[model samples]
Target: MSTRRKPQMHSSERARLDPFIVATGDASPRDQQDLMERPFFSLAKAKRVTPILYKAGYVQVEVYAVPEHGLATIWDADVLIWAASQIVEAENEGLRTSRFLRFTPYQMLSAIGRQTGSRDYKLLKGALTRLQATVIHTTIRNGENWRRHQFSWINEWEECVTRDGRVEGMEFVLPDWFYRGVIDRSLVLAIDRSYFKLTGGIERWLYRVARKHAGRQPSGWTFDIPHLHAKSGSQARVSDFALDIRRIAARQPLPGYRLDIEREGRRELLRIRPVKLSTESVGGTVGTLGTSGAGGIGTSGAAPSGLRAQDTQLTLWPETLIPGLNLESNLDSNFDVGPEDGGKPAPDGAASRSDTGRSEPVSPDDTRTREAQP
Candidate 1:
């Protein structure tokens, strides 16, 4: 796809700002909880012009994008995930951070588990363009005097090229809204690194939903099919959406979780239970993008359950719902505004594969044995 060329440096641009260089090291992937629960990006990889308008109680979000660049897809979100991981890693070591980031295309692609081919590099540029172009308006983090707050995922981005036109480095400025959310440890969660392996759009979104909602709760989390369908901002019909969800449940694709599709009278419910992975540790990195379509079971036999319009955000599933099932409790619900642990810091947990190392499927646990680099 053709993308706009970066503008030539003008006189005013002569005063260059120093960028935060992305260092080589393990960066335990983290995601902003605000971004995890909401529909901020298009689920489909195709150029989508449809605007997303999401509302739940006081929370409201609207996303708009230009046709040329299209709304950023969830796959594009790996870049943001990478950025969040970097900020958290830097802060953990007491290093300073800024929205301005500088790194090589290969460094990013490899870290995100994408091939470092020429095409992959081109695709990276496209993702950056879409991120910079997409505009978001939301009242999610706004206080009592809530009003329209608008911003793009990125303020701007550019490539540093040699005289021979070989791109050597890249730089981008992240918006303050996103930067603040990521910098604040309480607003982040250490997601399963295997999340990058799931190749479906709905599947990927569901994993984030799982990480955000389930956390390490013994009861895990339960959401009726339709409730999830709406929150997903999926374009699929309800029937199709439920079927896709059922497929994911059957596959049990989400790492560190066991999924069971159950029924309560006419209601079909999905219960996510935290399962123990033999080597599972809280971890992450990045991955390639995938696309998905949507529809719904809106008028399906049963009425939808649990719109969850209350302010407290409590999990109220009866204890007797499931009996005698052992569940593991190792992860944290960092997504919660205030976790019980007060959001203690963790070392960089990224598990990016080395170029010379043979690639193998990441275990559900994402087990790592080597000591973390300084």
Candidate 2:
């Protein structure tokens, strides 16, 4: 009877694992939680090195930024991965990160800095080289879903031909876990182009500021520029400049704080509202500059006295996108009208052009008017 005994029965039967469940489980615990609700990069592991996924279209990448343990904001990548992890993870859950994540190098470059044939370019190349060395190869599809993955570092000054001028740029992705950890509370301040040019590279300067302010509670910082100017007049009176400074400061994440501006013999003070404004709030400030008595803000000191709210104009920085950082896309898609013959066939004995001038052929309206008179 023992030899002929049937297989023993079990109290519970094993169930087939749900692929969906397994898929969700694959992501790191820290990555599953909503990042917006809780700042990523606040965790202990994040405090050590972390990864960030930044994609600009078909181009997906993962980059690592090491937080100096509550000391400084230096995100030097130790590893770079192009797993398209977010997309892979999203597919498992029947979703995807926003389409904005797709590769759009032209757009990506517009955010970091303009393309210049200078040292800044060298720094960008160096950064790219460092990134290439760290990237690892991996795929995340299901059974029978094999796909090869690879990423080529963009060569410097390669033309990214958008409808607008071929802009220059680069981008790397950050891992989800890394996203939730270090860059959690990172506040993106859209530096107005005018402001950056005034200071010569505002984003770079702000990165330095953020690095300096890293790990500390947001409190106060001072701007001690030699050529600080206010919209009021050439003198750059503190009172005239105070409102704009305070307006700019108020948009920052810091709250319940007062900002005091001082230059030479002028000082003006303003307070940050308890509620922080989104980056768009800064855009509205441009409207204020045009309509408010701050009219002179953009007039280059010619129209200083025209201070009326109706005259407010939004003096936005040349739109810059910071991927996860900037809320505004800051994309410029205006069409430039070239000469009728495709740019004034060189000014070789041609008319003195006005502006980036290209002379257009005589208008049909003139011919029509001449015939109508007969």
RMSD (CA, Å), each prediction: 18.2, 27.3
Please report, in order, the local distance difference test score of every candidate based on alpha carbons.
0.62, 0.24
- The number of the candidate with the highest lDDT is 1
Off by over 4 Å in 2: 1-95, 98-104, 116-122, 129-171, 181-258, 261-374
Lowest summed lDDT over 10 consecutive residues: which window, candidate 2?
12-21
Task: Report the C-alpha lDDT of model 1 over 1-374, residue by residue, as the tens digit.
Answer: 22324434343211233335565667766788778767898887567888988865445679998987788888888889878877787778776556666666655666656766666677778788888889999865554454557999988887866555656667687876787677666677887666665666787788887776666655666677877787788778999999998998887878788888878799888887677742342233333432212111011111111111211111121223212321221011112232211222212332212112211122212221222211
Whole-model lDDT for model 1 versus the true structure?
A: 0.62
> Which parts of model 1 are misplaced by more than 4 Å?
1-18, 278-374
Q: Model 2, residue 22: displacement in angstroms?
A: 28
Poorest 10 consecutive residues by lDDT, candidate 1: 296-305
